[model samples]
Target: MSDQPPRDSHVYDGPVGGWGSAKGIAAVARTARPGPGAFDTLRRQNKPGGMMCSSCAWAKPPNPHIVEFCENGAKATLWDLTSARCGPDFFASHSVSELSGWSEYDLELAGRLTHPLRYDAETDRYVAVDWDTAFAAIGQELQALDPKMVAFYASGKAGLEASFLYALYARAYGHVNLPDSSNMCHETTSVALKTVIGTPVGTCVFEDFDHCDMILHVGQNPGTNSPRMLHPLQQAANRGCCIVAINPLREKGLLEFANPQSPWQMTLGAPTEIADRYLQVRAGGDIAALTGIAKQVLALDRTQGGVLDHAFLDAHAHGLQDWMDWVDACDWAELEQVSGLTRDAMEAIGAIYARAKAVIGVYGMGLTQHVHGSDAVGALVNLLLLRGNIGRKGAGISPVRGHSNVQGQRTVGITEKPELVPNDALRDLFGIAPPMDEGWNTTAFVQALLDGKAQGFVGLGGNLARAVPDTDRVAAAWGRMPLTVHVATRLNRTHLMPGRSSWILPCLVRAEVDMQDGVNQQVTVEDSFSHIHGSIGKRSPASPHLMSETAIVARLAAATLPASAKMPWDHWARDYARIRALIEVVYPDDFHDFEARMNQPGGFYRGNPARNRDWQTDSGKAQFTRPAALDATGLGVGPGLYRLITLRSNDQFNTTVYGLSDRLRGIEGDRMLIMMSPDDMAAEGLVAERRIALTGAADDGIGRRVAGLRVIPYDLPRGCIAGYFPELNPLSPLSRCDLASDTPATKGIPVRLDLT
Candidate 1:
């Protein structure tokens, strides 16, 4: 393998979703070699009673598209359904030390894990172990430690059943230390929105796209993160709905899209212009931009009386005047400087919002992965509340989540906060007094591991080691743990970082059949829109040694818990309906008739009370929160420093690297490169392809740096830079995070670039 990163970089001026998307699918298919059956499986994605796309949390449309899967979705599905298998023989050939040197893409491409493997310290290799022995060993390790010292981490890929069982097992064993993928990404949305709108979830459904007059596309690249969303954006554009994109980068998806399914559009190469206007705001300037927009809206309301929704505000909201007063006090010069946008541009967007009868605010991790992520979300909510966007048709705040079923994991009680869990119901149902202590979030969990406070870790799914900030420090702490167990479909970087006693238990992927007690089972997932639906696997399992996640959790709980425990783990493992029944008992309002709803054509919508103006806050009304200042992220980027925004490539999903090509950005075979503006390159005396090192500019004494990164001149802000995630995650310190959400400030890290 070559040590040099790919230096081929050019401008991609094409549309986002035409032949480019089709070719992307073809490329993955070539690498995956998923066979002819994979095509049939693709057709079934997002269809009622069929398999769900495992890529993103975008809601399934009520009237579904024939081919619902998008490029990334196809990649995720084909990647899972690939024929390559990583058995004991493959492990025998490559030692862990040798495998650690491989790229993330190469590691996963090696194929799906086919058996349970236990780390052998003597041989320095993972040796195959029986399921019974693996479970017993893991259970014994857990039994030796205090429940508070054990962390149960879950990935969004797992189904609601598995997540519920995982949470139950953790709580029944006497701990609430349930840190999940949400902690790393959307925790800001949950924490901020709950305080603003009395609900942690978005208010709009799939049908909202049709009725909305405008969509404020804030800080999200839909083409790569969630391609299924393109259909709605395209439809919205064709129907003359105003779409304004607010982000640091001019994402191709937000600019234009061609429906691959539409033959005329594809043939003519006439892509739908998605965004009517695009604002390239500076990194960490989301709160300032939103505040400026809100200020403009308030100005319009003062000049034109009908601009503000006084009726809605008077009836269903609180703190409007206080927030409006704060906005009025903010000076235009400060707002412009902080937001990196002219007052005229903000006014133009505000004018659009004022004219639209109903507008939807759509954002992603860009707004939620900052030091003021929670405040940024709160600011967006304040703007929406000014026009009565919530509790109405065609209007609301929508945070586009990344992973499939991630929202469902939180819905099924996989959270560190004890208040989020239904402890009363759990105690009554399982006859166990659940711990109410506030447990560790992702940041705190890593700290505990480093401090030697945590002894064991159980990962339901996900690459947590690479997903979090301070990777080098976290990996070292992970190695020192007494025990760690990961239940996954494939081998990842997290699996390579073995603890003192580590075990990798292979589990069936979403594409594979999950059979329990000779009966085929279907697992349910909750989408970003809060729609609960069932997903049944259409393909065969990669290996006979694999078990379903639900079965693994149940069996592990049975093995770990005392004999006096009242839970019927064996029964729940055999039949998932029993697990759903317990879930219904815990969350009676949402999961009522869970099995019956799963059997429905499109399942049922888990209703949001805030949609109907029923506020669950202390004041019984939606509240307008005032940001303390124009700049929410308090990082000061001096002459030599830049505000670094971490990004995902077109060929990647979350931490899963599918390939080296980022077709949308016109970059092929590279992940270790930074994007900078031509002017900034010249000003800093740097050239394209120049190797540089980025050191975190945080005042903390911890020296965090990433070297051997090539610089690529692109269309970026003067003091702003961009790079791929996880590779740059090392520059974000574990301590520098959103105080309210504990989500690492991955989007806006202050870093100084030095020529290598």
Candidate 2:
């Protein structure tokens, strides 16, 4: 055998100057290999004249700072500005087959695409194509298909104007298949909230944290997912606001968040205490825990003769009788078995809820990505209703969203189930009827691919392949498509998933100038706080060849739509203000002064139905609903099988891996490990550090098994196990989603484990 050079030291020492030594050190060490730009990325973050928070949409630059940002924000900034660049020559040298073998990180690190490229299957390589030919080909393919056959996907990273035009084009062409990021993250919230509140958005404002006495966070990690949220969380905890975290994993940031803003904090390493009570529930057991709390609260109300806001429930809620009967009928034994919390723990949580003057219930994907996700969320809302938490100051339901403008994108008409087409508004604005019928969601879109019924896919700025579940299955499904058009900022794994003819259209990054009609136009982003702020990129584009997302979208729209549509497609390309004007018409009441609000310092909240107790349910009152419990008999006759919940890391986002480190979990470099209780591991005859294989229980005909999963014993509840998503997505069949929402139960997969 040929002699191989000695491998680099597997051991990871602390970084220079003692920074990122422990968790960060271990985090970076866990990655297969470090990105070349990791070290210099942060240095360039605050360089003498680099992009600053002042230019970011999440930040209010003119206002005095008070813990203005989070670690994830810093990571996003650094990752985007990294010195990695994969130019035209890189693609010229490597064939699609060769590049397909590389990992997500390696492909991303190769850098930005300098020009538009098309894959030529005969030559087995991608060749550079100019904007004109690329647009023409995409238009030709789109025109050939019945618009309904082509699906349009929108990512949260897409801008409002781009998304608006995208929605118009899809509807104008009569195809309603607009599956978006919301499908994966908060679609359940929409399904549940809309049924209760008549609107899909949240009821609380970001400022409510300052006024609330208690904040109940379930399954949301502000530390990693929304770093900007940490400031409010810390501020609330500091001001005697009771913070309760209910999650399977004891996240590091939820316990203590290090504020990078405070001078004292920065110098002395001050970390703020977050959760006053940490409830470690088992995976997929949130519904039971939440329902148990509700039962206790209801019982206490009866005992005390004043626990629930009976008057509020009477006036503002419907279906109370049904809700009460369901809660009363739940067996304590079943609840306890499913929730894995003691009676005392349940009472303790109930007392907290009953005593708090005002409380806010905030959740993330944990409450949404389950088999009964919508009903689970309804249970949470039912608990809030017992206390009259909704429609009150400092207390309401807040779904902390991922991606900057995901909520905004949904608000701007990107939906598979859009409400009736307001023909009057369409005629007054576009002078035509937009598609009124329902369309495909993410799950439905993927199903279409599997059936080989869909011919084309137009992704408007997202890594769809990695974000969706069962990547290998979807990869094979995508191969049947005749055309795939991707408009993106940089090259991602999605770009390499080629069809017969693939077009990669390069677009400007959100943090770069978007010039139109010989002038730099500013775009706006809505934050988790329901505040819309102006964003103008301070840095130059990664390359001069890229076009603004708006322009690319407009070009495609113009090419695909017919002349008889009576819409001014060409005008939208030269300016986005017109698009905002159209938005005002569509959402006239909410976005009354879109332009003026866009220019304001502190962005304004569009609507707060709860502020005035404006319950818009069918009965003019908030309705309570729940799904029947999972049949214990259905849970295979075995002790070793359990539900598996997949989660994101502190250093990562949804399907977008910045690095392999998870700072909160005390995990360094691995994403394939399972977090299980020591007793559970011992009972199964599994070692703590040994590798295991996780096989899924049957769901449809698609069964999956992930091997070589490192088992890490933690303080998790028995019958509960946790693993990272995308890596563990193979173990979750696409059919295993919530019935009401079609959200893949990534949080609840029945699985069996064995030593590898």
Candidate 3:
């Protein structure tokens, strides 16, 4: 063997959530040094009247563990509660041009923003400004521009109370361009679920895992994205529930798991195996694999009388015959080729599903961030419907949401679609004639900026500049905006890209106390399971100048809108309960008894009507959807061209990079490496650690390219490559997106790699 550095391709054989997880948490603690108080905050996470984890949106169990927090949750908490501070002095020391050169990790790791800041073009640096001055300037700018020229972008981190106020403020200003994080990640799920089951949210709860006999996990890496999910997968595995992992990579988390909280398992070095069979489906081939499995089930139903749920189908489902005919028309050879799997494997998975009485289908961005993501999600729902897996205990579709409260933001009227908003109710309650036209989603917002149509931007929270596709172009467009106001806790890439008149308003994080009108305040967040719970911070605010998200929105609304009886901005700012009361008034069905139930342990469940067999669709029944095509990517595959899939490291959450090391993937100190199959490397005459350049094959004439990405040969299918996101986000053009959901095809972009 050649004497060279190890090619960042070591396989991680250890079980998920063992000592490795413990080490990851410890590392974050060391880096953050959140002090002894952080331990108390960690202990209170996901508990009754406790703060929700700032990481993933996994539901908390009714009987919570003493250590309910996971490794990722601990990292996020520590990160939020870090002792480091980014005050006026820090900004005074560094210019925007200089700070723009820093890495994303360094920008966030520098510390929390302590004071509100306004960009001073004369000095090319940010200067401290009082809240009143900043708000007045922003309000004046908003007054000058048309409502349609401004876009209000909400991050998933904002709580329901804050999000409601933000949406209210946008509408009160006569604008509805409320683009949020959901527009990028789970918008496909929302669209597909609504079309099929008449609901936008998932139908399953945390307890469903306990009763599920089989779980079909597709396109999601629970280990890295949502580590808390491992507990349920472990329990289901221990009880002999057959789990079939359907994804391109054989993720270590789905293979086995050792609960770090369990002393017995950790001490014994024993881990419960997770997936009984791992199907390595090709990137963007989810529809084909789903169709292949459904075809096998249909064949089995034809030969065996008890295979299909005829009773459930006849009463609750529509368009079954058309869907079955479409599935029948799908050629097995074509499916095998597109899915990169054998027919026998699909048959095996179908057999397991046929034998199991209850099955749950779990998926993530891997299915949604595709060219045909809506179709792929519809296909998965169709597969689950064949066996009557929906609307029953232990069986339903679970889309693993990335950010906490992302779903809640949409539920509380933070959507761009006019139909989803309670326009009449808002008009009657708030005495404001909110815009009825559909506004900009994320993609449209970016396009508006690129086209110079957008004049102002108000971000509730998020690194919009780095998270979206066409990073360089988006940043350029963002910089050209007449005004930009960001409400955030820390310094992010989006904050650095100052517009002509930009402001960064410091806000309190989830782990910090929010005292309003001399009383402690609690905000509510809805989890992936549609359970709404209250989160009250235990620790003091990171900075004295930091304002609560609700307060920021309230004050901004007060500054922007004229004095009106219906819009009680000051009252809402004084007490968050007032905002929750309005939320209850707006969404009485979901938020009924909002205060009483929100104080209860684990809060209350926002019941899914579909769960009770009450289909809210146009036809009054769940509909079976036909896949547009077998290939979900809709990208051309050819020699020297590879389909790219973006991934998140174990050390990273959505856009927050905690560290450079990815313990689960055995990657360290680097984020620019590309993961490719050994066979593909050989075919391309590329060796491990060979630097290469990838150019996107988008037909929009935009040259999307990134260079100097070292290749690491790994266990993946041919004609496929993987890289960490935000780094590879440049290769994803804005034009290459799902038309139905407008979600960037980040998971399946066609690219050509050449040796650099």
Candidate 4:
């Protein structure tokens, strides 16, 4: 038995909503001066068949209310339409060296990018350059380099239209090096879900929350990462749904949520109590916990005939008896040892699952950002498959995504590994030969850059330098590149870490009203549940010079490719509907009747055959897998060593830091802090507020270490510690990654911590 950590000084004890959410929305709304009211902007966001909120991928309402966005959604919306402006004059005064020293928070606060800038070697400054000249310069470098040397990356910031064009452009250049942020976040979900369900996306829709009797949330803090999700979670709880939370930290939002949207919650009624049973498990131990639950469920099914849907299993699934036998053979002692969860607790949750007619298992990267990330996903699916939860009214497995359109980008061809090469239809449509060879993913691209095999790079969105593991290492490789281009809405750390020749091309954000050729245009984005809808900006552009992502890709494509390699690049850029029409041709089954659906109430679903129990897998039925997590133990991590997992603050979204204060966790004025269990802290001779250093446990030839991290003791699993990412990303070596997805196993970092 180990002693729990002391109460954190900064741990927020306040209820989720009440005045907190109201103040947050008001504060964010005020930042966007010279813009419309926050309520007005929110109204436009929910307008019938209008632009989707840029903040998160949570499902929006079909027939929405006047204020359709959550507090975080409001923050993301207003931040993009901020009154503060950053133009060429500001850059003229600030040298690249000076800007390099600024923090990510301060850099974004400097405001939206105003002009296209190119690095001037003589002055070490980014001076504004005309779009054509910048395009031509980059084109010449790409022409000089081998096709394999060019690495084109996309991000959630780029909508479906831009993503499709970027993927098309890269392949037209004779390669498929189109690695995006999906490779870093939910790539494991994409791979694992497809393996079992024959589709890469979730089988359930937002409506599932309403009908579900129980929700088994594992390894996710929806309060911070996906705050919007808290709305439905609270609503579900209010409706008497039993919610069970399995996480390292008992987050405030999961404990007590105050929905500002609900009048009863805002005024006098008690705040919606979220978790009926909150189980704290060791980080990366979710798979073991899940396995234990499945063991209990299997036992209940064998003795209690109706517990498992035997009919559904016999009709639609295979390999169940083998999986059940494997579960029965598991040792309870090892399950508790690995998961840090008691057998009694596991059985209690299993009993809940057995009794409930409908159950939904919702999870996040806490399970997928580990060494056995893919296996963890499969394990969750296995739990769902046991009771025939898929294709049901209120039952499914959801790997909740963080970004706005990371999934949508993948749907629209922002992938290096394309299953379909240019068939006769593709070749005839584009008049270009699609590359046959598979391309590099994020991990492959990183290794390629370090090995000096990759030369040219084009980033559609995202801060690649800071976002990737080993920030300094990635930045070094990026600087050595012959040419690099960033098409973005605002300034970021990656923009400052430039190549020998780099261009910063400003683009319109989701908040900005985009009018091409005097005609108003709208772009489409797919939510986490695979619902595609139109997004049209209500506010004016942050800068008049800023172009749309579609326009930027179109120009870049026109400049790089020879005229013989033909496509309707210019025409599609002028009218995005043309691009949608092309999407219809490319993916007819999904994007068919794209325009009419975009105009309809809410949006139409991108049909998933697996949702109807139509297994597209090679086996003819859903396959259950036994995860490798059973072997996961901090084996050699004894005295001074620990397994560290990186986290994001409630104040930030992905790599975009809105503020330094993490209001949800009650931390302020710093980001270099680590949360540890009391027993682990005492063992390391660490005291409260003491600064510490973290060194990579494994000697992978990359001596990764980070200093100046402050200690904060909290109730956490023993031998496990947590720290904020992008800051702690340096300590997490690139070698620590899942072999299945190449996603850096940031959550499964083995490290040795000591006083700084």
TM-score of each: 0.98, 0.91, 0.98, 0.97
The true-versus-predicted C-alpha distance at residue 405 of model 4, in Å, is: 1.3
By TM-score, the candidates rank as: 3, 1, 4, 2
- lDDT by residue (246-357, candidate 4, tens digit) is 8887677778888777788788877878999988888778888999998899889779778888889999887887887788888999889878899999998999988888
In candidate 4, stretches whose alpha carbon ends up further than 4 angstroms from where it belongs are 1-10, 29-34, 37-39, 420-424, 564-566, 631-637
- Judging by lDDT against the true structure, name the best candidate: 3
Compared with the true structure, model 1 gives a TM-score of: 0.98
Angstrom error at residue 614, model 4: 0.5
Task: Put down candidate 3 lDDT per residue, 588-618, tens digits, no spaces.
Answer: 9999999889967766898999988899998
Position 44, candidate 4: lDDT: 72
Give the winner by lDDT: 1 or 4.
Answer: 1
What TM-score does candidate 2 get on C-alpha atoms?
0.91
Candidate 3 wrong stretches, greater than 4 Å? 1-9
Extract clashing residue pairs from model 3.
Answer: none
- In model 2, state the lDDT of residue 729: 78
Count steric clashes of candidate 4: 2
- Alpha-carbon shift of residue 148 in model 4 (angstroms): 1.3
RMSD of 2: 6.0
lDDT of 2 by residue, 1-756 (tens): 111112320112221112342334344333324244433333333222222332122333334354243455555654565555667788878988888887666776676667888988886777888888998888888888877778999988776788888888888878789998888878888888888777677888766677899888998776667666677788898899888888876666577765655656655755677888888776666788888888899888889878889899888888888878988898888777777677677778898889988899999887888877887788788888887898888899888887778877777788887573355676577765767778999999988888888889999888887778777788878867988999876677777778888989888775566778877876766755566665566556777888888889888888887765457777867888888888888878767899888756556677767567887778888888766653211233356678787888766767767676764555766678888877777788876678888988755666678898888776666787888877787777778677777877788778888664
Residue 146 in model 3: shift from native, Å? Answer: 1.2
Worst 10 residues of 4 by lDDT: 1-10
Which ranges in model 1 have alpha carbons more than 4 Å from their true place? 1-10
